[model samples]
Target chain A: MTTEPRLVEVRKNVLKQNDIIARALRDRFREAGVLAVSFVSSPGSGKTAFLEKTLTLLHSRYRVAALVGDLATENDAARLGRSQVPVKQILTGTVCHLDAAMVQNALDGWDLTQLDFLFIENVGNLVCPSSYDLGEDLRFVLLSVTEGEDKPLKYPTIFNSADVAVITKSDLAAAVEFDEAAVLRNIQAVRPGMEVLKISAKTGEGLAEYLEYLERRCSSSRAGAAASN
Target chain B: MHELSIAMSIVEMAQEESERCGQAQVLAVHLRLGQLSGVVKEALLSSYEMACEATPLEGSQLLIEEVPVEVFCPKCDGPRALGSIQWFCCPECGTPTPEVLHGKELEVVALEIEE
Candidate 1:
């Protein structure tokens, strides 16, 4: 009799492994009382500019660190490092998006407990970044007014996945004839009742509100974790 | 392209499954892809060959089954297929529905391998 090998049916998501690691990282961040925030946006949307300004503003009050991802180049990390906050650059090589594996690798040798906030600046792409969860407590999606107000309608998936939407480069709004009402309406249409913040890294307008929002979210999550524990 | 990375994951998973079953080679991988999954099928197919090389899934074929977006119509109280991602209106009653029943799926459902 010919022996037949038994077929084992295994229906598991390839991303499940990454999810597990991400969940663990989230728990670790919670325990360490670190507010981990991530950013996703298209190329040239002023992510690095906003991040540099944010780091400079928050550096005095809280310990902040950042990890920047790109297909190639440490330029972003180098620029953000000028703010004098610890920064790491993740080179994804041929990969178009930043996965949890890359984040874990980048965080190696760093003490999570030392920092009050960790910002992960994802690779500048609106599409692929939404699929990977990097265990951040908050996700900020940036859209510059110069890009157009209908960006939310064009990239619903990214907007749907993000917790907060930030309209960057608001200083150029008047010059670019940016329609604020239309952008807000489009954002609400895609993600109903989502929080939207308008800011200009150059002028520092509305940066205070954004920081307060971050502080509120961080504290709320901390309270929730404490209650659960 | 992101397709190459996705293809690599598929190949790795297929290889692991083949080893578990003591299979000599993987013949095909069955995938269910939704129209709104944000994955370009043509790009994925092109990258699959390159990603699968030097792996157990080498020469394996990807069998993609397209899944249409199904939404629940509030006006009609019935399920309807979405023609496009932009338009979420019901074809029967022309009422807009935001509740999605099925779509945005990218999964490998089954594997055909030779023992």
Candidate 2:
């Protein structure tokens, strides 16, 4: 008998299971008619403040819920709860970023069909969050005016992966001498034809336009799903 | 860093693959890491050691193969390695190319196990 060992060729992505779960979540969200939006940014970029403003604006008309992720402390979740909408805190402990598994676990026991919008506030870190998809219908990457305008260039992967870019704290632009034009240019350079919106959560500026854009996206996706069905 | 998390995933995948192959031990895991994959190779290597401790993949080495960013330059009518991340101009001629052929790849290619 010839002594030969069989060599098995197995080519698979380590994140294959995670990707499958994420896809399932996406389909579930679509079927439930929930417009899921997620936010990712570096710490101190006003993500919590932005979400607070968004919840305040959206809760009046739409049934909105939020899931905020952080390394520790429920300060953000507590703060967002003031909006009088359902909010959950995902304490990742030592994890630098939130993954799909975390998102799914956080949503446990909550009826997604009851909500029109779901916002996932990812842990404040730019690098790691871009690698994992949390099954959100839209992913927004936020950059503050105080942050360098070349942030998009420095962290191209985050900007490239984001569906939309939000320039937060625009009220501080003039005080900080922020280069708005350069920031826009850098965003375009990294992801051409990407949707970018400028907003100031403190002053309530540009909030209406952002909401309108979100409404349009949700409706369009709904139309597409209807047609496919 | 997120390297630890990635390393943990690698170890888990290796263990599962070893079990599927009816092997008692994993020798190594081959990974294809592209230049633009946004993963630091040194950090990953160090984290791999820490992540594999007391796990099935203990003592298993992580073999990484680096891949350069390649883009299709319309001017050259072929693919060429991008020297830098900032500029994607043609290597042979001075022309900007918008087509991306390779880059941003982070995947485990294969596993070596003892049967």
Candidate 3:
């Protein structure tokens, strides 16, 4: 005998697995007193160069490391390894974005306590990375001047998901005639009150301010952990 | 692009639920997809069937409910429907709100199963 079809309520989140893992990672980061920063952007947004500069700048004074994700090849990881810090390459092999599980796996066996700052550079893709949270304390969405001022508007979900917006390749701003005000307006439209920073790793234009801001955030997180302990 | 993986997750979840219900055949799966979730509905629709292949969910219908982005406007003091995905301002009073009230949902709300 055939039975009738009935609707049953599930009300379950599709990303529940990833979310749980991300929460655990967040807690681990907090307990370990480390500031985790993740970067997302389209291909050729200068995320690697920016991260390389950041890691190099912080390597002398602090314990820092990086995990860079890519579809294939360890080219980025090799480039970042030149910073003389620990670097891991996550080859996704076809996965468009890095999820919490990949991050948790990449960080396995590492002592989070020894690290002052951990940087995760996501597989370069604006669309897919927005959906999966990698459990980073801060998500920086990078936008180069050559990519156009409307990049934020074109990819609003990513802008909304990110904590900060970095306009990279400022050294080519005039060559590309990048309109800073227009990009600012676009970012404000998608994510109101998002912290935006313009930096050019090539010439060390805004790295000092960005580095100081990062150090401040790291110190605050460490202080928070201390107070709690 | 990642919808295939997402679809696979949905199928896995539904399969487990179906098994819990004495291995009932899932006739249809109801999903709530939000605009701000960064998932394209059409992409998911195409990927759903592929994900269900060789599984109990094969040939089952995937019903999707699109959820629009809503933000809590400070000036309005209420939830406002976002005018556009790119614009987070209230369509009514034009107040910009950083607080997102909803539209991030990607959930399996219900399942139609044949007993």
Candidate 4:
């Protein structure tokens, strides 16, 4: 049977599956009034250290849980478990990034209403993670001082996708001769008016301010204090 | 990178679309890939062949149209194509145009199928 090929109009998002699940998760988080924050950064950018510091510090004041995604090991999960808060490891195997379905599955059995903060630590990759959204209220992209000021320019897509840029490993800024001004300029060049913060988990410097900022932003969001009002 | 997974998603979508059209065989998929979509066009094109293998969409071609980064220029009060992804500014007026109007598309706009 000879047949001609026909052109079919089918406009669809390639990531529609992930987007659908992410939307559901976002709605769930909104209804439960939980601020879900996701971290995306290149490898060795201090994502784990910063998160460990954050979870430990916020444990006493608020309910916190973490879902850490890695390629194969549960090492990050084990380290985060030291904070004595609920922590889970999602082994992505060969997957370079964590998608929304993985997050939705990992969050099973955990009551969102019981938690004030749920942090999703994505796999340590710059390019891939930016394509997937895990239903987070805030996406903080980390840029370490050791990585140089051109990091933002090199990975502008990820920077544009993130809500805030955190300058990590600031304690070594003096030794590395890190140019804060240039880094800030590159960040602004890629993403104009993006909020930026600097902190060192090692010295606990800027941790207090970061925590305050996190809480303040959460409350101001529609899911944060709308129920109370 | 993640382009393989993205290619797989496109193949999956094509299969479903073909099935909807009376078990038609998909010949090609037309995709609108923006420069700022965080996806590399070359990588995706290379991965598409592998993704289509062992599937109903085998031998299907992925025709991609690259969309340039466009930002809403607040000063100009109109859309402007950005010169570079690193710089989010209006090309003519050089205004800082943070509002992105386009160039983030990862959509499959059309498909060629044999019924």
CAPRI tier of model 3:
high
For model 3, state the Cα shift of residue A90 in Å. 0.5
Instruction: Sort every candidate by TM-score, greatest first.
Output: 3, 4, 2, 1
TM-score of each: 0.88, 0.90, 0.99, 0.97
Better of 2 and 3 by TM-score: 3
lDDT of 3 by residue, B17-81 (tens): 99989999999999999989989999999999999999989999999999998899899799888
lDDT of 2 by residue, A43-135 (tens): 999999999999999998999999999998999989999999999999999988888999999999989889889999999999988878899
Return the TM-score for candidate 4, rounded to 2 decimals: 0.97
Tens-digit per-residue lDDT, A1-229, candidate 1: 4345333455666567678888988998998889999999999999999999989999999999999999889899889989999999999887778888888889999999898899999999998887788999989999999999899989877876788999999999999999999999788766655799999999989999999998898789878878877
lDDT of 2: 0.85
DockQ of each model vs. true complex: 0.32, 0.39, 0.91, 0.86
Interface RMSD of each: 3.7, 3.2, 0.7, 1.0
What is candidate 1's local distance difference test score? 0.85
Q: Which is the leading candidate under lDDT?
A: 3
Q: Is candidate 1 or candidate 2 better by TM-score?
A: 2
The TM-score, computed over Cα atoms with residue i paired to residue i, of candidate 3 is 0.99
Ranking by lDDT: 3, 4, 2, 1
Candidate 3: C-alpha RMSD after superposition = 0.8
**Residue B112, candidate 1: C-alpha displacement in angstroms:** 1.9
* Docking level for model 2: acceptable
> If both were scored by lDDT, which would come out higher, candidate 2 or candidate 4?
4
Q: What is the lDDT of residue B45 in candidate 3?
A: 91
